[model samples]
Target chain A: MIVFTMLNDRFILATNLSLMTQQTVIVGTLAIAQTLIILTAGIDLSIGAIMVFAQMTMANLVVTSEVSNVAGYGWPAALAIAAGILIAMVAGGVNGFLIVRFELPPFIVTLGTLSIFTALTLIFFKARTIQGPEMPDAMTWMGTTFKLGPFTVMTGVLVMLAMYGIFAFILRNTAWGTHIYAVGDDPDAAELSGISTGRVLFSVYCVAGLIIGIAAWITIGRVGSASPNVAPNINLDSITAVVIGGTSLFGGRGTMIGTLLGALIVVVFQNGLALAGYDQAPRVLAVGVLVIAAVALDQWIRKVQG
Target chain B: MSTVPAILSGRGLVKHFGRVVGLNGADIDLFPGEVLAVIGDNGAGKSTLIKCFSGAHAPDTGTMEVTGQDVLFRSTHEARLAGIETVFQTLAVSPALDIAENLYLGREIRKQGVLGTAFRMLDRKRMRAEAGQRLQDLGIGTIQNISQAVETLSGGQRQAVAVARAAAFGSKVIILDEPTAALGVRESARVLQLIHDLRERGMPVILISHNMPQVFEVADRIHVQRLGKRAAVVTPSKFDMKDAVAIMTGALEVDEADQALGPVRTPAAV
Candidate 1:
């Protein structure tokens, strides 16, 4: 008890607030998006592709479009963001349509799109990363922060949290959310109950697309460059967070809190490993192993309960 | 004074699957506050008849009335709008979801804000409370939790849950497709009791089963189908297992003895 007291007193509670907040926000956003798709018993293999495509769209607009000059660099950035979201949503709609209409397996469908989207990105940017003018002052304000003594927080992180809060509400308290689970859990039952299983699947992929767009924007702001070859591990990362967060791969069972916690666990482990000077190969291996173990454990628990 | 004009009644219902006739000249009357057991052999038109009524198929020849209003259901959703809900032989219950969640699968309670933005929220508390009340109303006292998955429930309990969900969401008529064909003695008995309870609540029930004892035990009336035809309708007190089996196998005839026992057939083969 004395040691606990000393540790609490010596450690300024807010000292790590800025770092924790931003990191959590980033990881939380990705995890929530992953959770949404996982709950539908679907895997969005193209999330990484969607992200890259969105980024490339934004970059190309800034470099080639007239809006960039008119809005004084800020306009291009804004257009880039909107265009990214639109592209992602369109991709999402396509995903929803194909999966629902053709009754194709999501695995094969998304894999096909992953390649198509990445190839499109290559075609759009001519296989080169387009460097744009600096982001607008107002847009940069979103990435800015102020000091709170030894702590700091970025607006981007706050934005990520706000998105998480909204997503949490939707998952916990919406008819659409319940419908998603219903459709995933039993398509025939859901349809018999008067649910348009097609509509639910459509909405799911579209929403996933929207979330991917948001992720793309954040990613672009952080890295300042859109590269197709980069962030190839994003799909695995987001899926890992979702699985570790306790969302079942089988669908119809998930919680935003679980996803957030799972994301934190993943991000924390990665950061800690890097801090301890672990090599990238070992880090990748560890994360891969952890994902498998989490899934295995979930299955074991289900069997024992049964 | 029949209150609802035979909520769902059909005359000379005929359905053919190209070369095979699923339901041929079948006539059935499903009224409120009663249980009608549609019993037949495996290839009998029970499932086909159910599919037609549930909007999975449109009858090639028949006049169906809902509350005395003539209508042709193009899809299951249409049947649901007319308050005809069917719990399929597959049960149509998502094993992955909990009781309340499954109860309100498609027709979930939505809380809309001003201007109907959907705040997009669900009244989970209301859903749970109503689901609990519905389960209780059906005399299901052993349900451990509303949050417990449907897969965890026994076959009897699962059937009960499916029935309760049908009753809770679909109001006019609830159809059960071989509901108890998968249960044991005690379990089947429990489901039979549930059927009675449903009838007591004034909910019309259409039970499809091949189990003769169960048919005699629970059904207020039984309709025997043989080779896609309405062979007979017998009340439990007047039910004859031999006649039922004969009719199910298309062996029963319009003989002098049959005529003395029930109604006679005019200008028909014996």
Candidate 2:
């Protein structure tokens, strides 16, 4: 896509690059959480909902003026930011608990919680969008950009990259990390091997929640608003990034680096297509096609025959 | 009869899964330094019997003892803690994980210093080195890379990794549930040899198999399970393959007093 776009119009390269990085920050971070859950053979449909809900919470807590009698706590920005992250984490924990405790399929549990969290956010915050000016500097700090050599980079992008690096290391170098792969690969086998599959699963959801909470903060920074309805397609976008990144949706066969590239791939396609004079429909169509191809590719790779 | 006591034993173990009676008062005994092969027809409670012993299921009534002490395993981890390792029929290996990782799937070795103590970082170097040494000990020299994914391995090598895992940590008993049921003939032979080598190490092994010849080759005593109960316990030397099969098919019955039901060997000389 980059080469084709460059051939079409090389002048748009720098603009497209900047737009892609800025656009990918939120989804990129959320994809980290999604990748962790997917690694355990679980899908989280409530990721975007959790982020929006937490962002709303932070926005409402710090709003200095009353809107429609829904007065903000006028609280400190740091506490509100922490509160927002806490809500996101708790929301994530709830998703994990429901799936683990009831043995519910993660798809159904998160699908249901997706509505519940979204609804709760609307009901509590009165469907009001908190503008960027009202939000604390800390809440929008991730949007802060600086020059990195020849590139102008969003701080949120760096945060997402750091998250990827940390989780990649954890997966490669920790006992818990190996257990996650084992549990994801075969929960029954993990159980028989004396690994507490349940504990591993529960912790995975909780840790994924922690990452999602940080994503909430990043989203607030990048989008410059605390709207309950921001990034409506964000959840599917994150899943798309993970799938395109070559992490098997079937579970234990992908890398964190793949997800980063996956997120980049999505943004690159969208930004490149738009710059190449393609309509929004084509970009969406392209991502949909990429998802199918990625999953089909995973199926082929997993059939490593002896 | 040998005067030495049974190293691991189960008395009147009964397990029920919904309405299906898995183990209808099944009994099992494993003597020290002897390979006791557990054999039975389908639904005769062969797997169920071992599940109870391996902590996959808790028998409703029966009791299990290891090294003369009563042990109740609520989970497989508890069973491992009590030194009863089981190589399940499924091989229980994560194919995507590497050889060393599968060997240390549940029990991973952590790194030294704060990186290990606080950060929970794995000692990949130590694990790979030790896993290589273990495969070497098991005579599994075919696998050259400790980091090679198990999916890339052959059936025999995968079986070798599973058995090696059991042999590494199984202090009191190593229970193999049809270790070679899915392997080729050569692979089956290697696994049978693994059972032999484990027995040679003075480890009591409970082998579950349907192959009569293989069972006769490695098992010191054959445990015939019929109708979710212990039909009879006979040694390969005392009863031929036909006799064991007859006992399994319920066409022949051996009185409890006639059963060998004792260890054929003492401590390992090797």
Candidate 3:
């Protein structure tokens, strides 16, 4: 109630609302990917790094330089973007392969890959930022907004929604989805039931990679630049949103709708804090509080329901 | 009497978990339309032998034949495809999912159109209906909502769901690993009834349990495993509870002549 009054007095409610939707696109997209991984009782710390690396690839490919003009030499925008997404998928596939083939834990595997991907991004881009005028309109297309009622919605927001919609259907109404939940719930039970848990987990990681790549494109659009240094804490932020969305970190019990709400809650809190003159410290502190509160709430609900 | 061919047989099955011996030349033969109870003290290779048959573990040295044809199982999925299903002691049911979803966890039915072929949409309505029907067929009509999550169900209901799933898909044989180890007395009785139902349906069942009453109640032939091998095979009428326990603990031994005589009156039985 106090926050609402402050917003009304400031009269920047509409602006804040629009900014929240736009802000949600990046973290919200990452949370979707995180949802899949967490559902399998796994985590991917490399999500943000994978997104950044893919964005850099997209940026460097289209903004041609003398030394980096391999594919940028008159390459079509669609082809470059496709190649960027493919590169992200390949990186994700490698993570899956290492995990399943070697029987390593997802935590350690993704942690190692996170550093490797970040280093690869820095080495490839020479720790440089690709900025305005060099970025093509095709790459920045997601930034374009249209009026919906009194609200201005960005194309990236629509893309995020569309992704959520497609995956919601898949997770709720498919054999693969059931297998995922089964594998996450109890791997031994799943194996005895004849579900190939390794294949399920491997596919989940790869599909999460695909979603993260799409997020990379959205990140490029939102920032209007491809920078290695942007959203460095995005990995933790995505996990925060997922956990706050009521998805259990332990796996097998969450919804896409909950994740979307989680993303909205995060953006709303940050926006409200900034509007009220609170600095970055309070904003980060608030997110940490929300994460713990959400997990505690989940435990309570489980006990009551069980 | 005409002989019935065994649906599944293992000869000299040997398995070792690292340095510990799980099975030592364990041999088993599962006849058709019979409930063969494999019971023993804890860690007497009952589960190991079942795992070998169900493809969860490969025998270090042994040969398995399904319906008289030798085959090798690389994984549980292969064993399932070859018409063998196992309900592990853990119940092997995903608690978060609904009863219908758990029923069709690994083998979900898909829609018969482009939505299924291209998009892989599941036929949820059909699956739910079939799941309900399957449970009812197994005489488990107490489950009112097929969409209720398995975690919400009672212990007996969950066990019923596991048994129903095995009975639905297991074409050749269903191997149950202590299906009632965690159930209440009433629930245990319900499970025993379900086992009897499966037998009446002509589905061979391999019941692994520590409960002597349950073993004697439902099992047509009891395979007493001792020291990682078959100690003796006896019917409930031939060997009383005392004799069965004595044989399992190696307190009583049957000589070759007495074994050849088959179900002879032992001193303990008197």
Candidate 4:
């Protein structure tokens, strides 16, 4: 009985580790879209706003949009995803237009849109939070308890892994991926090589918006409600994961695997610190230190190679 | 002596930067299995002509033909489709990427899945192997690893890789602008040999240079540009560096103005 109990204790610890791992993966997928945007030598300060906007839009659609005439559960779910993604695309598209067409610096453009998108999100909710429908029996299956051996995994985890895999494939295999790297490295040079830098930037922002939609889906499923004010520090965390993952903020010098590793590091450290009773101040300090260290290490590696 | 449609030919090419004439009524024929050197002082429209051929800017006037077919290229991709690749003086390579990755930067070959899905990603193994082989074929056996990023390569070696990429991608006509302008004597000589080797493989090469010795060394024919027009096409056997300079600076024509001032400038596209 003692031996069996020991084995069960060990199994529980392992399961907890796996659960943390799943959460890190979820965070990593959200960071990836941002990583890509940064890789193009551009910044998307509005990622947080975009993510929240997607969540609020989808939550309202599912709950308040009433199961009126024709469309039912299946249709609502699909339409919610589609609408969330579409809204994000339009938001991202506006960002793209301001940057590409107006010839404005991406930093200023995104900074302005960051405020605009947040305001838009608040407008959607009428300055109030949206409570998503009580997890439907079928929809609840996605949020159902998952077990891999002794470890429980959420649907969010699986979806994150799948998205990461897709991202890795797209970055590695497709011509579009090549164009992304090309545009990020040197827009003028890439243009000379026949890669449309503006188009690449536009597409990246559009894809970024789509990823926000996916993130919203996962967030709603995880929390069972959409609050615009939730996780105010998420944007910073996402950026921290991306930078620590080894994707250069300067662009054209990062990997999805690196970013995933980075996200895991960020989450694992934060969770472990929390488990050990560290305060929020120390956690924030560590993340800031991590960003600096990653950037310095990258520059050192580049210099050494030279 | 032999005809192959000049590989790439520009007729009546005109480009203007809002009244500042970059290239005005210029024409040039780049022949395969030969090096045609374009030489002039600054503002002779050499860069403009090269850019037009490379699809950087659409010519405001004139036609570009490749392999004898009139092509209207709006972008470099169009020029690439017609097997015309240009190695700009800036090199335009991603120093962050490895040698092989840079070589296959745009035209990466891969496996396809059912219904045209991308299954096998970037055939990297094959690319590395082929990149090695191609480099060796171009007489570049000194590179230890194709995976080493280009930032690690020497100036001459980077230029070699750039040229090798253009050559490997099936560029029938390779246009290089001042490729060795920044290299030292030994490095420049090494680059010149690569240019010569390119010709031996039946690929037409356009070598744009300011160095007369270097130009006379590799070029089979030298086309001298004087004030946005090609004034002379002289073979290496009958070339005079001083006379070429005089033509390039329009000094020869100025000297002849006292004797007879006529449009004797044939405007030949060599």
Native contacts kept, each candidate: 0.71, 0.85, 0.93, 0.44
Query: Which residue pairs collide, candidate 3?
Result: none
C-alpha RMSD for every candidate: 5.4, 1.9, 3.7, 5.3
The residue ranges of model 2 lying beyond 4 angstroms of the native Cα positions read: A7-15, A66-69, A296-306, B267-270
Q: State the weakest 10-residue window (summed lDDT) of model 3 chain A.
A: A66-75
Given candidate 3, what's the lDDT at residue B194?
A: 88
User: What is the docking quality class of candidate 4?
Assistant: acceptable
Q: Write the per-residue lDDT of candidate 4 for residues A1-306, one digit (tens) a residue.
A: 233224344323766577676667546667988888888988888878887887777666665335322122433666776787799888888888889999888889988988998899877565555444543433333455577787788777778878888898888766678778878887776776667788889999888888877777777666656678866767777888888888878888788888888998777666665555678899778778878988899889978856
Model 4 Cα shift for residue B157 (angstroms): 1.3
What candidate 3 gets wrong by more than 4 Å, as runs, is: A8-12, A66-74, B255-270
Give the per-residue lDDT digits (tens) of candidate 2, residues A175-287: 99898888889999988888888888888888887888888888888888888779999999999999888887789877899999999888877777776778989989988
Best by lDDT: 2
Query: Candidate 3, residues A12-104: lDDT per residue as tens digits?
Result: 556667878998999999999999989888889999899999988888877777534333443566776787788888888888888889999
C-alpha lDDT (0 to 100) for residue A39 of candidate 1: 88
> Pick by TM-score: which candidate is best?
2
Ranking of models by TM-score: 2, 3, 4, 1
Residue A87's lDDT within candidate 3 is: 82
Ranking by lDDT: 2, 3, 4, 1
**Cα lDDT listed for each candidate:** 0.75, 0.87, 0.85, 0.76
For model 4, the DockQ equals 0.44
| TM match of model 2 to true structure | 0.96
The local lDDT score (0 to 100) that residue A89 gets in candidate 3 is: 85
Number of the predicted model whose DockQ against the real structure is largest:
2
